[model samples]
Target: MSTLTTPHRPSGAAPHRPYRPSGLTWTVLRLHRTALYVWGAALLAAVAALIWLLAAGPDARAIVGGCDASEPFPIDCGTAHWTTTARIHASGLALVSACVTFQIYAVAVWAGAALTGRELESGTARLAWTQSVTPARWLATRLAVPAVLLTAGTTLAVLLLNWTRRAGRGDLSGGWFTMNVFISSGPVAVGYALAGLALGALAGLVLRRALPAAAAALAAAYVLHEVLDGFRMSLWPAETVTGRAALQLPHGTLVLEHGAVTGAGERLSNNMACVGTDSAAALERCVERTGLTDFWTTYQPESHFWPLQLVESGLLLAVTGLAAAAAFALLRRQHS
Candidate 1:
């Protein structure tokens, strides 16, 4: 047998990474089991319950009977609804609750905040990170699963909400559901996970102890998540002059300073309509102030879904990127 001598490969650049799945992912999945179950299972549970309610509940028309003809705002039922105002709002609220404003996003960010910050404190995460896996990659892959699952969960939850909302669209009160729910891989969701992940990764890489980090991450993320995500927009109420008793816009953040109103008969410079829910809200504040044709009483308050999601998510992602980079940099410098 002639042994052919193969030429040694010259080193110029690293070879392309093979398409095989990284076994590191298994470690991530293993590390993230509790967090996933807590967030994912809870979300799935909520969705399943929603599905059941939607499937089992009375049809919208049956509940509605002939309420479209009433005063305030009426749809095409055209017969002048005889129902009381309370019943109108009650019936309309089913659709309202399905909105991102009302339920899905509310549940998701809160749920994610809960999931991300608690891992290290429990002494659970370090079991994997101490191995060949770098702490940054470990944290990233761990967070990636839940973020993905929750994003899909939000999308599906919103879809189901849409399905329920569609059933009642013949009624104007039901139109709130017709508006899209803006939960995507958007900044808010990413920010939420990042909030947790950053805090946790910081704890893991810096503190080297999971429990303290987990507890602190969860507590801090919990306290700050909404404030940060909404950028204090949701924290304060934006007074309207009662042209209509419009619910505050989700994308249109209102800040309230008690006993402050403008001389021009406007609510206040900061408290009223400073941020309207427009598609352009995604751009920097220098881009636009007022929203599009979205803030009218003819529609529900949360018609601008995407902008809110984008703003919150954008802030989160920005912070997350910075945080991950910082963690990676810190870990690289560690003596261990």
Candidate 2:
């Protein structure tokens, strides 16, 4: 009975190997560890900022107002909105920038490097292709693990931001809000980060190398960010991200473009209206004298909340999702 139970196995039978990562996976894990500190720091800053904003009163803006531009780092975020280049810092405000940058340099860049990039670089991918795991699974596991965890971290950051901003406002205004484009600011970041990873891999597919792939992907994504602010700016008629009918200004109305201008009662400029002089008073006096050809309204950040948040987030997410889908398909089809 014992003999029957313990039938001799052929030498070719699978060996009783102890648990061990495939050499490729080990390389991936080793590389990913470098990103931990980056991810940790971004999340930590977000949490701390949220805590500070809640504890500190609204007047805390006063302290940060005077901060000089030695480098936006260690920026006192309390008065960040009041500063001139306010929007520039918004990306960094809720831990979004730190996490996004970390993801870009680490996960996004390294994934491209390790997946097809490293293999193609060392001339080892051909060797790896002949191993036990198929190239697709190899790529999938390596990309998926860190990506899933990263997405979670990003989502948390977004939530913290939303909480803090609401606390700062002391109430939730429900119209078109700018800050809400990122509900937590962190989610879109994570979304973009993942999109970056997928893009890096796709770049690997396209270039069949790592360094170039990573660089191409990161550069492409960044340039898109730069262009995005101006994306529908000239293209879309008015307020591509938000909509509430351009308010009627005193002389004309503030069009999306060309603020406080000479002749625009009928013509609506997009974001600006250029009046002859600086002062709203001076502009009004000119309008009274000239019999009001165009209206001139200055920029007013939306005071309304929920409506604005919904629209901006929706449009951004839609655009991001489309970009991501394309990147995902590109990654999936790399070996296909």
lDDT of each: 0.47, 0.53
Tens digit per residue, CA lDDT, model 2, 1-336: 354476678988996779977575566666555566666775687677656655654445444564555756645643464543333234335245344434544555655666557666776755666777666666666667667777787777667655655655422322222333423343445655665666666666677777787787677666654554344223323332211122333332223444323444454444333343556666567657755455433332333223434443455456546654564566567557
Error of 1 at 327 (Å): 1.9
lDDT computed for candidate 2: 0.53
lDDT of 1: 0.47
Q: Write the per-residue lDDT of candidate 1 for residues 1-336, one digit (tens) a residue.
A: 799896676789666686864576665556556755666665666576556545534443445464534556655344334333334434443443433333333333333333333444454546656667666675567556655665575566556655643553324333322222233222343345445555555545555544554555555555655465444344233344332133233443332331222334444322334333244444234223432222222222343345555656666677667766876687568526
Alpha carbon deviation, residue 272, candidate 1 (Å): 14
Using all chains and alpha carbons, the TM-scores for the candidates as numbered come to 0.50, 0.57
Model 2: how far is 306 from its true place, Å?
Answer: 7.8
Model 1, total clashes: 13
Cα-based lDDT at residue 17, candidate 1: 80
Error of 1 at 111 (Å): 12
